[model samples]
Target: MSQQIPFVDYLVLGENPHLVANECAACGARFFDRRNACAACGATGFRKAQVATAGEVRAFTIVTVAAPGVPVPFVAATIDCEGTSVKANLVKVTPDPEHVKLGMKVRLATHSLGTDSAGTEAIGFGFEPLETAIDGQ
Candidate 1:
């Protein structure tokens, strides 16, 4: 069997992939990366918070340009998940205005980023259309 790992420390990849953020206990601000102090309130105290899988698109953009070997016309979005805004890629939908819109529901989804020669798989998470999330393809 292949070993599975997350693309980033904040993302937990496996059969049930989920995003974990550090929350400021003082101000209730959530951060995706490790932090010494809270940006919102400068509090040093924090707690690990598992963000909601479902969200609504608060903002987005269709990128037409990217680095070499990177695909273009991908949707990058800010999703409001249980009051926390998470910035991630919007996948499994056409990258068009008609397909992607603000206030559209979405849910966490995982994809294979690549595999190491040692048979370890690196996976990343993104938000996909919520209605189809139940199918879990």
Candidate 2:
């Protein structure tokens, strides 16, 4: 059997998938990328912190145009995951104004992007509506 890998380094792919961030030890600011110093407080220390899987949609936009080969009419959103702002695509729902709204509750979800020649699948993460997640959809 081939192994599955996360598309991003912070995504932990397993029975329970979640994201981790580098948190500033002094200021408590979380960042997904490596940082030598805290941007908010100029702290030089950091620690691994688990990000909340559940979040609220703080803002979103319906993208109708994109680069060639990329799909259009997708929801690009900013989610507030326990006070941390996460920029990710919203999936498993129609990309329309009526369906997606600000302050909508969402939960992290993973999907298989594709497999490589070595048969390793790359998993990507997204946020789905809370209702859909609760219903096991």
Candidate 3:
């Protein structure tokens, strides 16, 4: 896999860093990373697309193992957007698996995707329960 990099100033069209992916104009399939050709139909038709900013949690898993740059017992999930589904880590949720489940309505939240000591930033999306958005009052 390639290192995470920023290809555009606006990560996603709407606001607060929407999870941006790409859809094939030929087959109408969505995939990550900007592509020049459709992976499904081999057509030179593609455009930048963004996933639904809010969706329900289709599945979830907790990571108790440690790895580079990732903390132990972190939560991850398969978030089902309006139509397309993408796997992403859940942010601002309970660090416990018992507290998460399928069909939980989760909202999109932005995170510092990645960072280098030199101060470069990469912005990506995460999931936050709707109440978290309101509780920061």
Candidate 4:
């Protein structure tokens, strides 16, 4: 069996790959990373919270340049998953303003970044346009 590893620490991979966030128990504020204390309430209590896979694009930008070999014109967006905002790349469609729009519905999608000669695969996650975009509403 090929071994798999997450691209980031908060990403959980398996049959249902999902992202986890640190949710402040006191104020219910969520953060993508571990926090020393709640930014809203200054509470030290927190819990591992599973974020919803579906979200709406709040903002986005078209990238025309990136590191070597990386594709250009990709849509980098800030998505609101439930209540938490997540920054991720938008995939599965043309990366343009006409196609990728603000408030577009999207779903979490995962892909294999690449594999090593040792048969280990690196997993990556992104958001893709969902059925809600079909009518272009």
Q: Give lDDT per model, in order.
A: 0.91, 0.95, 0.74, 0.90
lDDT of 2 by residue, 7-97 (tens): 9999998888999999999989999999989999998999999999999999999999999999988999999999888899999889998
TM-score of each: 0.94, 0.97, 0.74, 0.91
- Runs of candidate 4 with Cα error greater than 4 angstroms are 132-137
Top model number, lDDT: 2
Pairs that collide, model 4: none
Report the number of the highest-TM-score candidate: 2
**What is the lDDT for 123 in model 1?**
85
lDDT of 1 by residue, 1-137 (tens): 89888888988765667888999999999998789999999999999999998999999999999999999989999999998889999999899999998999999988899999999998888999986676765
True-vs-predicted CA distance for residue 129, candidate 2, Å:
0.2
Question: What does candidate 3's lDDT look like per residue over 11-68, in tens digits?
Answer: 5633355766787877888877667787778888777777778888888888888778
List the candidate 2 regions with Cα displacement exceeding 4 Å. none
TM-score of 1: 0.94
32: Cα error in model 3, Å: 1.0
How does candidate 3 score on lDDT? 0.74
Better of 2 and 3 by lDDT: 2
- Which residue pairs show collisions in model 2? none
Worst 10 residues of 1 by lDDT: 128-137
Instruction: Residues 100-131, candidate 4: write the lDDT tens digits.
Output: 88889999988899999999999999998997
- Spell out the clash pairs found in candidate 1: none
When sorted by TM-score, best at the front, the candidate numbers are 2, 1, 4, 3
